[model samples]
Target: MRSSDVSAGLAEGAGQAAAERIRDAAILRYGRDGFAVGLRAVGADAGVTAGLVLHYFGSKEGLRRACDAYVLSVIRSEKLKATTGGPAVVIAQLAEVEEYAPIALYALRSLQAGGELAIEFMEQMCADALEYLEAGVAQGLLKPSRDPVARARYLATQAMGSLLLWVSLHPEFHEIDDFRKELRQLWDEIALPALELFSEGLFVDRTMLDEYLMYVCDPPAGDAKP
Candidate 1:
């Protein structure tokens, strides 16, 4: 609980049991802290030396890579099926779930801070999204003039800004954490319609888009029962 608790994941050498045990400890600690995402604190709480955690992970960045994988595991174990409705649907489904918030916030914060691991993760996700956008345009689901990269940037910016706003406005979400489910629903469900409207003909609806962005850009409005 103390600031000194800042440490890394498990050390370099150990058996699978030890690594798994360390990982389990980290997850437990994270949940206890209401899902405060920290590789160091996780390591400390796991009862492993910071050096050991670093040894296993190579660095805090490395630990994040591992944590990200663990999060994915959670998604899979939970049978998080990809939605049939395309990107908006998929994202909306992800957003509606409460479990995704802590990791989502952690990921967004690290990405904004330009954390190498987070950057890599975002880059990969964006690249994947770009492929989808480009294909959408080609298939006439979106505007041909649209730049997939630009749209991806817009989405990234919006998502990151949303996370920051939520963190700033709703400290209770941090107090109890687990804000991801509701937050994702808002982000993935309600806002996804607007994102879908980003297609060719719909792109010109600046008023609608602006309204959506305003909500995303501001957090106090998060309390609104829209």
Candidate 2:
């Protein structure tokens, strides 16, 4: 290639790198603060000017969309890792929970913000969950679900709902200076019960489920309620 072409290619690569840095910094900022955080603050965190940020992302909303996409991709990658790697890999990942703090906090902030973006994030999460859950089943790490899509949605809803409830119950969690510490505390408190319930299950038998399926979900022709 000519000298000019080489310089243009190098500049394009640098611009892509800078844009990625800005996107990552925005994730950390939005996770720590909220969506209301300004582009200037994100630029400061990214070591770039706000004008550069705008040039790269077009607007704050564009930057946010990029962050959301990146966060969702991270979530999918990590969950797929767990699905394919099994319990040992999961335990190892948990040991390095600090690495995930920013992503987790960003997701929490999105949910806490509560709007169209939050709903979109959640729907994407559910879709990703369904993908990984199917992978788990294929790998024999998880049982096949009768309604895999519904099961994925239910799992996502249950996990997020429980997290929101836990955060609401412990307001001091938000006051913690270290986001990683807060996440660790939350994991430490819930890990045992959540694992036990998921592994051993809550019900001693399937009587309740059987009855529900029989009476509620698919009642006899004449047994329908008014």
Candidate 3:
């Protein structure tokens, strides 16, 4: 390759690196500050000029969209890794859960913002959940679902809803100045109960499920109950 080509390639690589740095910084900042955070703050956090942030992302909204996509991709990758990597990997990840604080906070902020973008992000999450959940079923780590897609969507919605509700109920959670600390505290509180419910289940028997399926879902022919 020509010297100019090599220099241009190097410059392009540097620009991409800078853009990723900015995006990551924005993720942490927005996670802490929410959607109302200014671009200058993001740039400062990223160690770049506000003009550079705009140059790469065009506007605050554009930067937010980029953050959303990046956060989603990171979550999808991590979840897939956990699903496929077996119990040891899952345990190891849980040991280092602090690493996920920024991503989790960003996701919570996105959902809390509430708009078209949030809805789109959530739909993508559900789709990704379905993919990984199917992988878990294939690996025998998770039970097979009669309606896998709906199950995946339901699980995603339930998880998000539960977290949001917890945060809402404990307004002091938002008073924490450090995002990582806040996430750690939240995880410490919820992990045991969530695991118990997921593993042991809430119901003692299948009677409720049987009735729901037989009566509510697909009732027997000529059953005049309705």
Candidate 4:
């Protein structure tokens, strides 16, 4: 390669490295301090000047969007292993990288903050779920829904709600002394079941749903006796 090309490649590599460092720092601080975590603090944590962070991300909102994208990408990579293991697996895996727990918490807090960032993140999540559900239907791995878009929304909402609830109740789980153990327990009791409900559903005899609805519309003669 030409010397100029080699120089350009080196510069690109260094830029990427700096960006990753800033991202990691932002994740740690934001996870611990929420979206309001100072960019200067994140830069300090990354061992980079605040100007470098600003140059890479442009603004705090830009950094937050980057974090959301990174977190979602990580979750997507894990989801590729199993159809319904994304949220539960991601939550459980965060225990392995304790620093990431706060990043997950930051995501939960963003939902309540209700800004453009939250909307964009949620829209991306729902869009991804819809794509996955549609593909599953084509591959015969999942039952086809009459309204796949609505089904995606419901599934995504359930997953997000379960994560939010788990993070919000962290204090109770923390009291268990072994948080990883308690988190796993909570996952089994809450997240796993919620995912199962989305994947397998609750009813053993789905045909009974029609029967029950019919009965609701017109009662049996045996039920007429007062």
Candidate 5:
């Protein structure tokens, strides 16, 4: 390659490296301090000049968008691979990304703070989750609910709540693996029971439940019971 081309390639590599460093710093600090941390502080944490940070991300909000995109992409990729296992697969995959706990915490903090970006991010996640649920149904891995959209919303809300609770309890544990093990155990204790209930269903006897349903609620308008 030409010397100029080599120089360009080196510059591009260095720029990408710097951008990633800045993002990591932002994620770590944001997890601890939320959006209150300035871009200059993130630049300082990354050992890069504030000007370079701006050059790479345009603004603090832009950097946050980048961070959100990165974290969400990682999660969605794992979720896609876990589709066959349903929500349990997704939970298992969460344990694999423990190294990115800072990013996970940052997402939770962002969601809790609530704004246009937070709402948009959450909306995107719920939509992605719904798509995953639809795929699971199609693959015969998940049972179809009478209202898939509502089911998706409930699952998304619970998943997010679980992450927040995990992060809240994380500092009490000394070791990462211990925390992960505990989180997995907790998931089993909680999520598994919920899944079992869903699979086993709510009513003990379908005939009795159907009788109650027909007696307590009106039938179809044109097909009301005589």
Candidate 6:
């Protein structure tokens, strides 16, 4: 979501070809980490010079941003793929990929701690959820009486909080099944009520929504290439 030409998808691929390898290296490094990592360390891991990493990505922030873009691209193009339904349907589809939770936890931490780069990703996520909500309204997949943006926010809150709590606490319990059940109960019990309100009415600023979604979704093409 961090713009500035370091966007995910095809634009990312435009860098002097070695882009995918660099991106893959980022995946390995950051997916398991501590502290603000340095480009030199990442470059060493990638078997490339720090300058090469910088040259390709522009800055450490840019490299990190590219990493995010690639990860989100995977999420959107893969796990969160549109299936023919509403928000809950999309969530249900997403749940099938259990790996999403850990990665998302990392992202959540980044958003909470990071500056502009994190904010950009957060905006992209919110935009995508809002877009899905709007699509539901447009297709009459959801009730037309509620505010879409508010609804999306509620869903985001509940979903994210649910994942965080379950991931954090489930290990303390003796029976994993019980933990899963409790999490599902929270989803069915808590998330449903909030979604009901969304069904009544929810709205978001369309232009801002589009920009953010475009940033994350990596729509078909076009960007400044060097």
Estimate TM-scores for all models. Answer: 0.53, 0.90, 0.89, 0.75, 0.74, 0.56
Candidate order by TM-score, decreasing, is: 2, 3, 4, 5, 6, 1
Residue-level error in angstroms, candidate 4, position 156: 1.0
Q: Scored by CA lDDT, what does every candidate get?
A: 0.55, 0.85, 0.84, 0.70, 0.76, 0.59
The number of residue pairs in model 1 that clash at the backbone is 19
The Cα error of candidate 1 at residue 211, in Å, is: 22
lDDT of 6 by residue, 85-157 (tens): 5467667644653444335545544554567877777667666677665565566555442355666667656
- Using TM-score as the yardstick, the better of models 1 and 2 is 2
lDDT of 2 by residue, 1-226 (tens): 8999999999999999999999999988887778989999999989999999999999988998899999999999999998878999889888887778888878888899998888999999999999998898888887776578888999988988887776667666443247688778778887889789877889999799668777766543342121
The weakest ten consecutive residues by lDDT in model 5 span 217-226
lDDT order of candidates, top first: 2, 3, 5, 4, 6, 1
- Model 4 residue 185 lDDT score: 61
Candidate 3 vs 6: which has more lDDT: 3
Q: Identify the runs in model 4 with alpha carbons over 4 angstroms from their true place.
A: 84-103, 171-182, 191-200, 207-226
Predicted candidate 1 versus true structure: per-residue lDDT over 85-180, tens digit per residue: 356655656555666555565454455456566567666656555555556555544453334476766765675676667666766644324564
Poorest 10 consecutive residues of model 3 by lDDT?
Answer: 217-226
